[model samples]
Target: MATNTTTKKPAAAALAETAEARPERATRRAPAVVGPPLGEGQEPVTVTLSHHHRIDGTDYTPGAEITVSPDYARGLRGQGFVART
Candidate 1:
């Protein structure tokens, strides 16, 4: 076998290079109130997004109504969603 001469990059430098190759991800803001949560002993409510938002790789356009559980709706509320009332 023939002799070869080569140099390896430092770990930090390699990481920096990889980081630069990836695009920055969009940042998310706190969810706003659109409507009140479901009433006591009531069924799931139909909710809509007040503004364009993205959650967990899913895009939710404004004015879109979706039937979701009260618990889930509450969670979505923090993610900028609101009930349709």
Candidate 2:
């Protein structure tokens, strides 16, 4: 009595060899900035809200001192937020 069965490689070639041994991971979009960034003659600058923020409704607690502009303070300093120069 002997039994041996091995045959599995049809799932799109095992997902293309696990996506080529995996090593791409570099997709992190979502930084295009929105409205209410002190438009109309723009010239605000001075940003420093490393955390809490609101906007139009106004809140901006965390280290607040906002005054956004300059392309929304460079899109809130690329999200990490930290501008004052």
Candidate 3:
């Protein structure tokens, strides 16, 4: 008669081996947009808000007067949300 024996690896060791066999993925990110600096060579203008609104994740109450770049103020004025003074 003959006897046979087998050995098993521990769970932690098996998991570590599996992890080591896989390659890691590189993280991806959005490309940055290049443009002129804010209010560059442009005069700042003050505008009054017509109603409560959120701009660039910030909230502004109605009748709030804010100083912003001329280009930004023009866009807000066109939308009737602000009146440039």
Estimate the TM-score of every prediction.
0.37, 0.29, 0.50
Please write out the lDDT profile of model 1 over residues 9-83, one tens digit for every residue.
999999999999988987965334233455678687567778776654556788876666577787878876674
Task: Please identify model 1 stretches exceeding 4 Å from their true place.
Answer: 1-42, 54-58, 83-85
Worst 10 residues of 1 by lDDT: 29-38
* Candidate 2 vs 3: which has more lDDT: 3
TM-score, predicted candidate 3 vs. hidden true structure: 0.50
Q: After superposing candidate 3, which stretches have Cα over 4 Å from the reference?
A: 1-37
Candidate number with the higher TM-score (1 or 2): 1
In candidate 2, list every pair of residues with a backbone clash: none
Each prediction's RMSD over C-alphas, in Å, is: 11.4, 9.1, 10.5
> Which structure is stronger by lDDT: 1 or 2?
1
lDDT of 3 by residue, 1-85 (tens): 8766777899999999999998888785312211222554676667789978776556778997777777877777788887445
Error of 3 at 54 (Å): 0.5
Q: Summarize candidate 2's per-residue lDDT along 12-81 as a digit string, tens digits.
A: 9999999999999999642233335466787766667777767655566677665556887777778875
Assess each prediction's global lDDT (C-alpha) against the native.
0.68, 0.67, 0.69
